[model samples]
Target: MVIEGWGVNENIEMVDRVAHCANKLQGWGKRKRVKFKEDI
Candidate 1:
């Protein structure tokens, strides 16, 4: 379930747009969200 291909199958237009936007704003670290690990 990575954000490369499977995450953007096509039907999820909003997701694709957001991910693409994040890629561009990565330098600024503007991308929001906190990913947690099961082990943690």
Candidate 2:
């Protein structure tokens, strides 16, 4: 899910941050038996 027209550097950084958070949340959800509407 890319946002349009962001600067390259900012986009890369944001994607990295989002990916990290998604991974963390996925791990937490798995432990808690939570379901997400969509996979990241």
Candidate 3:
């Protein structure tokens, strides 16, 4: 389910926003991995 706008500028903005979310997800995954290792 992707919600995109109609326009070049809007598309760029959406991409940037999505990229930011992706970065956060990557960071969160790394943190979780470290915690899992510590638990083991």
Candidate 4:
């Protein structure tokens, strides 16, 4: 989720929202790559 909100949620809830999303995507991508390699 590309979080681009401003207010109590974005300003106070989390600091590095985009970084967090990127990290999660990286992890998910890594898992998918591993699965694809295994399948091949």
Ranked by lDDT, the better of candidates 1 and 4 is: 4
TM-score of each: 0.36, 0.51, 0.69, 0.62
**lDDT per residue (tens digit) for residues 1-40 in model 3:** 1232223345467677687667767777899999999999
lDDT of candidate 2 over 1-40, digit per residue (tens): 1232333456367677677667766667786664454443
Kindly indicate the candidate among 2 and 4 with the higher TM-score: 4
**lDDT-best of 1 and 3:** 3
The local distance difference test score of each candidate is 0.52, 0.56, 0.64, 0.64
Error of 3 at 35 (Å): 0.2
Q: Report residue 14 deviation for candidate 3 (angstroms).
A: 0.1
Q: Give lDDT for model 1.
A: 0.52
Model 4 stretches astray by more than 4 angstroms: 1-15
Q: Write the per-residue lDDT of candidate 4 for residues 1-40, one digit (tens) a residue.
A: 3443223265543556656666777877899999999999
* Clash number by candidate, in order: 0, 0, 0, 0
Please provide, for model 1 over 1-40, each residue's C-alpha lDDT reduced to its tens digit, 9 standing for 90 to 100.
1355334555667777677656656633432323233334
